[model samples]
Target: MDELRAQLIATARAMGSAGLNKGTAGNLSVRAAAGFLITPTGMDYASLECADIPWMSLEGEARGRRRPSSEWRFHRDIYAARPEVGAVLHAHSPFAVSLACLRREIPPFHYMIARFGGTTVRCGAYALFGTQALSDAALAALEGRSACLLANHGMLVAGRDLKQALDLGIELESLCEQYWRACQLGEPVLLSAAEMAEVLEHFRHYGQQSGQQSGGKTS
Candidate 1:
């Protein structure tokens, strides 16, 4: 458990180093025995210690030296709703936030769109941060998907573990940037549903056949 806590802290700091987040504008968590361990709200990731991370129950009780991230509601909800998810990451990344501000659902303009387990990444309905409404909206947008944009806010990604979750977050933000840049040129050409379906099928078996983690391949 202590080791997991330390890894969570390292991952949180890595988010900033990877440019997926800055300041305390993101939160990360990994499933735990009692519940889940989450990064504390509004703290510098650089200074975090294992004990500073909070263990939050599915019912919302938090334990540890620090308070849980304000977005812990969605983390708890995702764990409760998605049995396969072992980690959740939310970030106010630049490109993702830019698209979220437009409330745009990313279309299948690229084959990587299927990497998220769907043809499009839905923009969740807008709600105040830290509210149950936000969690509900996110869950709806994330149906059958590993990631989604929070309308007017940022993005959320879930994975089988911390590494995968962080990788997805990075990939999602990169896609958002590509989409944004392409849109600046013109309405980007979008792939048809059948095209994305084919891509999704390919992704299902794209990675190595071993238990080794593949950064860009999920599920």
Candidate 2:
């Protein structure tokens, strides 16, 4: 349990270092034995200790000195809804926020769009932060996907564990920036549905044969 907490903390700090988040603008959580361990609300990642992370049940009861992230409801809901997801990350990265503010869906301008489990990254319907309404919108946007943009907000991603969640958060931000830049050059050409389908199928076997969880986390 201590090791898991340490991993979660390290990933939370990495989120800031990787520029996927700033200050207390995002949250991360990993599935725990009873529920999940999440970064506390309003705490600086640099100052986080294992003990500072809170354990909260899917039912919403919490344990630890600190309170769970204000967005804990969605983390809980994601875990409840997606059995394969072991970690969840939410970030307010600039590019994602910009596109989200426009309520835009990132079309398949690049084959990497399939990396997110779809040909387009859907932007969830807008809702106030930290509310069930937001969680509902997020879940809807995330249908058949591992990542989605929260309208007028940022992005949310899930992985089999902390490492993948961190990687996806970074990768998703990069994709958002790339898409934004492409848009500035005029409407970018999009891949056909058939093309994206080919990429998706290829992605299923894109990596090693070693048994690993989704998003490329080996352990």
Candidate 3:
């Protein structure tokens, strides 16, 4: 558990340094049998430590010196609704948050976005933090997808583990940026449903087999 906590802290800082999040605007969590370790509320990513993180049960009870993030409900709901999800990442990234403010769904304009396993990314209805309503809407929006944008709030991404969840968050933000840029030049070209089906099939296959071992030759 100590090593897991340390890795999460380091990954959070890396996300911060890479501009995925600013100040205390993002939160991360990793699942455990009893509960999960989550970043403390209102603490800047640069200053996070293993001891500063709080452990919270799936039911939202806490056991630590620090309080969980104000959006603990979001994390709890996701874990509860998606038993397969082992990690959750919420980020207030610029493009994704901007799109959220507009309350618009991110359509699958590029094939890479197909990794999300849906034809479009839904935006959850606006709700205040830590509220059950927010959690409900978020869970509903996330049906059949690994991620969703919280209306007027931010983005939520989940994966089988911490590293994969963080990677999905970054990919979602990049897709949002591309969508916004394409919108500037009139309606963007969207992939047809048939095309998206093929892409999704490829995604499932790729996900099933861990591709390209790290530090290994590409070819």
The C-alpha stretches of model 1 lying farther than 4 A from their native spots are 210-219
Q: Give the winner by lDDT: 1 or 3.
A: 1
lDDT scores for all predictions?
0.92, 0.91, 0.84
Error of 2 at 194 (Å): 0.9
User: Highest lDDT among the candidates is held by which one?
Assistant: 1
Compared with the true structure, model 2 gives a TM-score of 0.95
Backbone clash tally (model 3): 0
Residue-by-residue lDDT tens digits, candidate 2, 84-130: 89999999999999999999999999998888888899999999999
**Candidate 3 — which residues are off by over 4 angstroms?**
207-219
RMSD of each: 2.2, 2.5, 4.1
* lDDT at 108, model 1: 95
Off by over 4 Å in 2: 209-219
Clashes of 2: 0
Tens digit of per-residue lDDT, candidate 1, span 1-219: 999999999899889988999888889999999599999999989989888998999999999889999999999999999988999999999999999999999999999988898999999999999999999999999999999999999999999899989999999999999999999999999999888878988887676677866544443
Error of 2 at 124 (Å): 0.4
CA-RMSD of model 2: 2.5
Rank order (by TM-score, best first): 1, 2, 3
Sort all candidates by lDDT, best to worst.
Answer: 1, 2, 3
